[model samples]
Target: MHSRSLLSPLARAALLLALLLATAPAMAWGRLGHRLVAQLAWDGMTPAARAAALDLLQDEPDPSLAGVANWADELRANDPGLGRRSASWHYVNLAEDGCHYDVARDCPRGNCVVAAIEAQAAILADPARPREDRVKALKFVVHFVGDVHQPLHAGFAHDKGGNTVQVNLDGRGSNLHALWDSGLLEQAGRDEAQWLEHLRGLPLRQGAGLGPSDWAEASCRIVRSPGFYPGRAKIDEEYGLQWSATASRQLRLGGEHLARVLNGALGG
Candidate 1:
């Protein structure tokens, strides 16, 4: 009877292991499983940059608006787990901590993403570091570059920047953050590349220009935009058109900003 009691714990462990293994494949999909945006950036790079970008992407691999739809489709095809988890809340903690700070607290708006990028930069620059660390850092840099482009991720502290504000997404109950993160991408449809191309064609804001600092500042401004809110629900045709346009503009800016940063970092 004592031996039987000891065996029960082992049996439970075996059951737990089996459950984890059964769900592992499903969990290995969507933005959480693979770094979709980082992969896209890596794939789109020149041969010289590709090698370095691969190293950067190893640590972080979340997708951007331009690639989320494609990533989602691939996730649906390859793993059932993608449907269960939402990547929208990955940066929620940053928003909660950084936004609405008086002079006392450090603002996370630009600092959070910057820290991640700097970590990658350090790994890339350090020759003594293990190759694995360099590789992981590069990947993290790639992923964080995309993160800084997300306006809500740069938002104010109050209300957790819309995470607390529940709303109906096309009549399906959801929240503001989810609507911005994946819903907007989903609405853009399956043709992510074409949509991205269209966005790239928009005229740049003259003299607005782009740099890492500029991008960060722009994101902060967007986060503070009056249009960004939780329960102020207005999904009319005009609102849809405006919001889509805004999202497209932001995506283009993000890609362009990422390209510039990579080019400068690689000394190209």
Candidate 2:
């Protein structure tokens, strides 16, 4: 009886995919990338850390440590209330005024990936907090750690972390941010486990005790580095060949550092 056009489930899903491809810029490390990072962290966790994490996840829909890696993102999609409130925690908008990362100017009111990670880490480390609270914090920590490591997530204000900057990948319409999110990784032609194994084989260059803010800045540095942001909007085989290596490195670092942070927080 309504005039509004209702799309079929498949059609609606296609529309959602398109919109998410455009708007899900802050889902740093993409679905596969986040899974890979969490899996590595789970694998590397000490017995005590694993026990602590498992204890908190007793009631989780996906109780396995890595299985709940996308808990925050899934929550964002399904729970509108908490989803809207926590959206900004995914990424910090670094103003284009040079390469400085002043917490006040870059990350105001503690609504950013770096600040969120630090806050959640503190919460998870606090044994006095309720189990539920710590479990939620653990999810955010797992996600935000991956977010800060995505070079485009720590993006400039001008282009909304390259979301506004249009580009092409393998002759398809896309944006700079989305390309790095899943486009680059999808081309790897391997499943998440294969990707994880490949990344684990790489040497991780962990900074000497870097914090969340430092991790964001590291991603920013990579963004500023040469051969990342294509001079032109359209990209092809050459660009992919060059930047896939950097993408791999970023994923590796994300997984490595996530393990370190969780290990430290859980007293591993």
Number of the predicted model whose lDDT against the real structure is largest: 2
Question: Could you give candidate 1's per-residue lDDT for residues 1-268 as a string of tens digits?
Answer: 0011122444433432333223321121124212434433443455655555544444434323233323333433556574233232123233443343222243243334454455556666565788766654454455556666666656655655455565543333445655556444434342445544555466554242544444555666766666666335534223333466666566655555555555545543
Instruction: Please count the clashing residue pairs in each candidate, in the order shown.
Output: 10, 0
- Give stretches of model 1 more than 4 Å off: 1-47, 54-104, 107-111, 169-171, 203-213, 234-238
Query: How does residue 27 of candidate 1 score in lDDT?
Result: 20
List of clashing residue pairs for candidate 2: none
- Indicate the TM-score of model 2: 0.87
Per-residue accuracy of model 2 over 8-44 as CA lDDT, tens digit each: 5444334434533554644666788888888877877
Best by TM-score: 2
Clashing pairs in 1: 35-61, 37-63, 55-135, 56-138, 56-139, 57-138, 57-139, 58-139, 99-156, 99-157
How many angstroms is residue 74 displaced in model 1 relative to the true structure, after the best TM-score fit? 15
Candidate 2 ranges beyond 4 A from true positions:
1-26, 169-171
